[model samples]
Target: MGTDVNRKAKHILIVGGGYVGLYTALRLQRRLSRELRDGSVRITLATPESYMTYQPFLPEAAAGNLSPRHVVAPLRRVLPKVRIINGKITKVNHAAKTATFQPADGPRRDIAYDIIVMAAGSISRTLPIPGLTDIGIGFRTVGEAIGLRNRVLHQLDVAESVDDPDLRRRALTFVVVGAGFAGVEALAELEDMSRDSIRYYRNLSPRDLRWVLVEATDRVLPEVGPEMGRWTLEQLRERGIDVRLNTRLESCVGGKVVLSDGDVFEADTLVWTAGVRANPIIESSDLPIDERGRIKTTTWLTVAGVRDAFAAGDIAGVPDATNPGRFCAPNAQHAVRQAKVLADNIVRTLRGEELVGYRHRYVGSVAGLGLHKGVANVYGIKLRGFPAWFMHRTYHLSRMPTFNRKVRVVVDWTLALLFKRETISLGEIHHPRDEFRAAVATGRKH
Candidate 1:
């Protein structure tokens, strides 16, 4: 079967630029190349950013082991045939076959499409903890990762410059809430970076810095199973990291962190990797969503009972065909694979052929704990320390979008082995306009 040549042109609108959007569109570009060239099928990808961030590398990016730029692939470059819109689809009116497109700047407009792919991925799931909005930072984006790195290094500088004991103590303490893959890896990597940086500081030592990991649950890396999780917990504790399990962050009003265990301390830096929720933008769409606000999707990766509409990744509650009574876990592993099936299914739909369902066995999990440290349980085989770390890097490097980024990341890693990791803080980049504003104020005063 093939696409009907007599039918009208079809437009495929893809929402979000994460794994699902990028991979699906890339596949469609190849699968429907003839249609795209003939103007019979059009693909438009609308996302907040022009680049798709490879989130797994975010921890290494924060640790200065990978360049921030290398952690993302430009959407335009990757999908040359697909029209890339550096904006967001604010609302989806599937009944009307139109979506509200809100650009990074300027007025909103409605776009018409024959089919829509809901890939508007998840966002940092924050809590109502006091002062969290004022003080805490998430580890989701490249900006946040790099900003946390600068904040950590800047805290070191603050400790070195200050003579007050109380202030120094606060400056040296770093707290991370959540011991999941993101939380643990981020804490471990930054701690390793800070420890390496201590040798360059005159008044600082590794002992002076306090690193804490607080998880509401009793274990870490739950996806890797209890055995590997317990092993990982032991490894972290052995590195002098304060792993506080069964603890919730009661409050962080001011820099004072109050834990559920009745422990209170002042920390200058607080990193929140607690969790992520589906992008609330999904609420505006007229689609069937699950209890968690994720769009309901079938095993074929199509929106449940909604023809010509698809969803995958964190935004979709796609049922696991391999595992009954459960949905696929929201991870890169599943997202990447689902995209392939999703793209193939779309082509099948276009050709008036039977669509295929997505089904894959759980391959296990892998997570990095700073340089030369990691844990992995792929295909029921367990590995720890350098082997795990090597596997983590190798697996992620291969999965990273585009060969250019993969080579750049490898070069960054290669350079790290030959030289020391750069610990310089560029916090000023966060407030670049501050210097200009100060100059204007000075001129007014003069």
Candidate 2:
């Protein structure tokens, strides 16, 4: 039976709490009319995390320039009216109007809804390289950022105390496999942090650390134009970063990284930021998907031939109205803008109004290569050095979700300028139970 217009309230179910899901709900919550707001609609958002991570700041977070907690918007705190479920939606039974979800601590359960928003964003795209799973870490979430920082600092501690040459070398070497914004920013920021941190350790010096970046394609920072890309390469190389162009990481077996360029080396840390694919959950859903496994949506951000279903962000292939033949790029700018359109369209659909198409022109790209260094090209205006770096900070700071978060991020930057970057690594945070387990085992042996 259809949603009873007279008695039952319409339920809006959002599958993921990332950029699209969170923003769409926020818009809808604010724009809904007084009558509908009272009790006509119920918005339920189900996500793996209770917070939405501002991913662009992950590099700075890793370098301890910003607090990891401040980089995420807690859904419960931000969206008080929306029902937030700390669970993952495993499958969507659209035909039956039911969705199955498994909570972190409970068995699978199903919920019925009148509308479904498929905003289940992307996951790390990994290759089947040997030992990759055992050694590699991704740079997608706040947890990964924190863990990487801890591991990097911990490795320095190990290198300082270890006397074995091979062990020391392995501990000192750091490899990042990707050259996009995520990879480049992460490498630069972490390198800067590590260099500054080395002064505290008398045994370690700047020269002792080796930072390597491997990209499968010809150049790094492809989002930025060629000129800025070249400038980024030169800047990174000048700072002692090994930028391996046209190179691929074949295998990372036993901590030894085998590259396509015939180079093999042992490294203690391997960060995989190569790329991302749509969330695998979409594949199982009965939706029309593109070749890359993204849900096929019209320019208006609605799933083609599906009623009361909408999608956007990295998971949906919405054709770009501005660029006739192509789809919108999977980036924060597009995701945020498309969410606005998607939200408005949802409202329009409810009001029986015409939906508008999603259209956005390619703005520009920017990358920060450590502190006081960056590259950018905004509306054909090229820039590099500290100017670009300032632009990077300015743009992201303004676009950060909430005003509170924006203020906090500014406070972080201001404090960073006044004080020094924090260098302490809480590696044990990830394995808090390990030491307790070890002690229990020791007592049993005794």
Candidate 3:
């Protein structure tokens, strides 16, 4: 009877490569090593990228304080026992126990599995303001962070080289929408980097740059509470950053920013870090989802009213047991912790044991506002300035995926203290084949 129970073969399919997907797989690999070795259990993770990006460090990476490569962990190296597929799980047919996998360079195919983990994370939630799509960029991925860095530095170069005052003014104006963690940190880091870079340019000065932050809400960093948010606002205003609260971006037609307060300006750079919505892939699946489009999950991390299906992270509407009548916030704090519980439950189910529910108290929030500046509220303990900044770094460093990545990030920070931030923009990297194409055309003519 024992051998029969242990010999049962099962396959687990995990979709998405973000925090929940990566961590859950890591935990399951360790828990099911014997089953894997005996060919009684198999795990396959499908993700759009081969590596998992630690989004919390993106701001530092954008400011050139950390290398881009160090912010992401290669999934293959971390999960050697699991099968990694570089693709997207386009759709999940739970009734049929199969998911449609669309590989990076091939036709779509169906993957059969005994259990499915819907870890497909959220995407940037965008609005339909005029010219917003054309002019705006987001700060979710490492590419966007590094790209925004290049764009900012490139704009400075344009401003310096141009003789037209209007063009130069437009080039120097940077507008960031939303005052959440992403928007605030991104604005602060880039502004700090740009301020440091101005000393090298003879024509540009700190006064020449205009940094504007637009938000519809009356406060910033709502996660840290109103008092700390107010403090953060004051700090930014003191740094000459224009913080517009309770205001809406009416439009940005032809680079002309028309605000709800009748303010008008031309800005070449517009960053939209407002929010994110659950991945549309959830809609394609047969899983039951809430009105917000997130898969409804029980405290045990299992999909509501569905057998052999589980979900966690930003894509799941997981009820917060700690806060009655509320769901868990879509953040790294919940995702990381929930993943451990999720993995353990899966192991329990395989062993015919009782599953465990996931519950954890909200620890609080921490945010970095450039070098030696930050705000944090941990367990109701409020902190600001250098102390908060140090706490933010230490907490995130402790959470950063692997020890290998943690060491690289520390080295990057140490080097930044010894050297000035590099402001050179390698924009040509976005179009590497352009020069080769031009050469080919010349060769054909010759």
Q: Judging by lDDT against the true structure, name the best candidate.
A: 3
lDDT of 1 by residue, 12-61 (tens): 98999999999999999999999999999999899989899999999999
Lowest lDDT block of 10, candidate 3? 1-10
For residue 21, model 1's alpha carbon misses the true position, in angstroms, by 0.5
> lDDT tens string, model 2, 1-446?
12213337788889999889889989988887453568988888999999999898899899998999889988988888898998888888788788888888867788888888999899999999998999999999999999999999999999999889899899989999999999999999999999999999988899999999999998989899898898889989999999999999999988999999999999989999999999988867887888878998999899989998999999999898888888899999899998899989988888899999988998998888888888999999999999999999999888888999999999998999999888887999998999999999999999
lDDT (Cα atoms) of all candidates against the true structure: 0.92, 0.90, 0.94
Q: TM-score of predicted model 2?
A: 0.97
Write the residue-wise lDDT of candidate 3 on 202-257 in tens digits.
99999999999999999999999999999999999999999999999989988999
Candidate 1 TM-score over all chains jointly = 0.97
Backbone clashes for every candidate come to 0, 0, 0
C-alpha lDDT of candidate 1 relative to the true structure: 0.92
By the lDDT metric, which is better: model 2 or model 3? Answer: 3
lDDT of 3: 0.94
Model 3: residues >4 Å from true position, as ranges?
1-8
The weakest ten consecutive residues by lDDT in model 1 span 1-10
